[model samples]
Target: MAKRRALISVSDKTGIVDFARELAGLGVEIISTGGTASLLEREGIPVIGISDVTGFPEILDGRVKTLHPAVHSGLLAIRDNEEHRRTMEELGLGYIDFVIVNLYPFQQTIAKPDVGYEEAVENIDIGGPTMLRSAAKNHAFVTVVVDAADYAGVLQEIKEGGDTTLETRKRLAAKVFRHTAAYDALIGDYLSQQAGEQLPERFTVTYEKIQDLRYGENPHQRAAFYRKPLAGKGDLTTAEQLHGKELSYNNINDANAALAIVKEFDEPAVVAVKHMNPCGVGIGTTVAEAYRKAYESDPTSIFGGIVAANRTVDAETAGMLSELFLEIVLAPDFTPEALGILTRKKNIRLLKLGDWSRAAERKPEWLVTSVAGGMLVQESDVLSVEASELKVVTDRQPTEEELKQLLFGWKVVKHVKSNAIVLAKDNMTIGVGAGQMNRVGAARIAVEQAGDKARGAVLASDAFFPMGDTVELAAKAGITAIIQPGGSIRDEESIAAANANGIAMVFTGVRHFKH
Candidate 1:
């Protein structure tokens, strides 16, 4: 019988030597290339150089080595066909029983700090993916292994039956296709970004598994966490857990909501969120003061909520936070005393996000939502309007303090669900109404929540008011000033209502509609 031949080439050499040595002990001829061949030879395993079988030296810096027909025909030829046997004999070709390969580290290379375009392009593997696909296409005749994790099973099967079963070959072949497709997708995504194509015809994304969760939002649903390959700095995926139990699906969602709200503030801010909505938001000179204001904003709802602070958590803030029954606490940094205090809570999850500057430096990203049969992709909502950009539409202009409070309310209301209304005063949210069906109902809800506190506070609406009823409700609630996107057909009605009530109103023109 002719000797069984196996080709081994890999960038990740984990368990390669042991696998190769075992194959050699099983009387399988080993064929290798470049560094793999050198390592195999050094480990005392006999190897047939790829160039030796191709009958040509590796040219073009080793890129042209495995493209020759000699290597491919060996893997592609049928073992049982008489015509294939004749062709193989005539061409002096032999059957390659195994093709083991792993592609170059293009992902890793591009992840470097200052990876040049030439360096990134050089790392893209041509010969490896080609060989993997060829072997996989003829998987019925040839065995292919792209992952080192499969080495043990293949070697065991070979030791038992002298060859891998068809079933195993087919499974490994499917894995090969998935691996190569993902690799190609990564390359295409990188090149597309380099070309500055924002919305390409084909949108492809890749994510690496972080963990298999115990369950999804519900206990019955299975779920897992995946991180983007090139996630921006200060992203939640880059957060380090300092203390507490593993994060749950709900915990992550609420924490992300809190983080987004806190990012809207450059000052020391604290946001307490429940069920993906900010129950309370506060900005102050110090984080501790912010925490106090946030807690006072909605003390009942802030219980067992996710708390995120834009500034470092000092001992003073930690002391106050420890008094509450919160789920998670996230911040850019935490003092040693603060960590010690917060770590005392056994079930509370603490996440530390380093390098807060990256949040400001990050470019806009795509926000994708999965629908029944398709996905909705759009640019993220990064539009922000300054106080100076607002145009007073009412007869009364907002005072300096009212303008500051109105801007603060606008930032918080933008993150709230529409139809949304936020009542804020002194840089703190006193009431919030979100996800209502009508703008008037939302305003009423906020007014009801604020009660006496709504008097003299500024109101922010997520979108335009279709009618004057919303303005009338705000006026009745004693809301002194209001800010909203003014594009409704009945804009004059709302303006007249605001003027009649002596309430200051401003039009930002840019609507923030978050659903």
Candidate 2:
């Protein structure tokens, strides 16, 4: 067999120097371009610049360096064809056996606090995707790598067998295609943001294989975790787990939702989530008390819901948690003894997250949602309208106790489906109406569930009332205060009814429609 040629280009220099040095020891000639070539050359390894081999000067502001036929033709040619070799020999093309490349850091660059639009557009790579696609298209003849983590395995296979195995080549080729696809999507998303339109068809989702799960939403369905690859700089996927079982599909969903809900509470808080909705939420003087109140909100729902704590979980609270059944618990820190008790249930997913003490300090711009063949994107509901901002159309202003319960109900209702209603007293939810056909129906169900407890309690509605019917119903159920997003055309009528009935009402000026 003749000596194989490997081309390596990467923006992330992590382990590239060492990987290139080891490839040199394997008698493989290294070809790279631009910064990669310059860096490899600095390490005393003889490297061939892509421009030198292409016989074309790097043009178009360095975008045309590796897009020439010399690079792609060498990568895509069928190695087993006699005519292919004959033509390659005439053109003086290299038999590029391996291509190691990762694309530009467009995600990281755009996430910077001061990144300009032109700067983001410039970070987009043209030649990198060309090389990657060409290499993947000819996976039968070459090996391709898109991840630095695969470097050791690739080197081990090459050293032990003098070539990457056929299976490794196929897998690496798959990674190359996924990499290019995700790259294109990132660019599309960026372009759409500049256009000020939420376009789902503009971007496509492609993910590399992270790990296969034991099962999917159910025990029978197949599942795997294909990370967004690039989410927030230090988002949930970047979370470090000090102790826990491998996260299941439901665990990850519930945990993420639980954290999002608990992050809303500015004070020390704990929330219990089930099926991506908060079954219980509580804010208290201590994390243990918060957890207790949240748990007592509905012990039945808390049985297997994901528990999220904004503060640390200590041994005392950890011991308390051990007494119940829970699918997962996410907190900032856990004392050594707390972890010891928590780990007794091997299947319980335990996670330690960042202290959300700074959650009140940050404000994000947009929230993204995906649909089948469509997407809906909007500004985040981080807007909290102060009481002073509330227009007091009602004759009665809510007392402090009623205000607390109203806000509590408001939080729980936001997580419920549209046309949703929740009734609450104290720190616990007394009743919940979810996925109802109409807002009035949702309200009735909630009041009915609370029964005698409905009197003097507060109610929350996810959307505006079209008329005074909902307020009339809440008055019939003896609700002392009501909270809903006020945007209806009949907002005056509802306000008049609330005032006439002496019901305390507050407008959030923000709607939480969870359809």
lDDT of 2: 0.82
- Where does model 1 exceed 4 Å of error? 152-167, 358-362
How does model 1 fare in lDDT? 0.92
Tens digits of per-residue lDDT for model 1, 1-515: 89999999999999999999999999999999999999999999999999889999989988888997898998888788899999999989988999999999999999998999999999999999999999999998999999998999999999899899999999999999989988998999889989998789988877777888889999999988888877766778889999999998888889989998899888899999999989999999999999999999999999999999998999999999999899999999899999999999899999999756635533567788889998889977878898879999989999999999999999899889889999999889999999999988888888998999999999999999999998888888899999999999999999999999999999999999989
Instruction: Give the TM-score comparing model 2 with the true structure, all chains together.
Output: 0.83
Please give the RMSD of candidate 1 to the true structure: 2.3
Per-residue lDDT of 8 in model 1: 92
Tell me, by lDDT, which candidate is best. Answer: 1
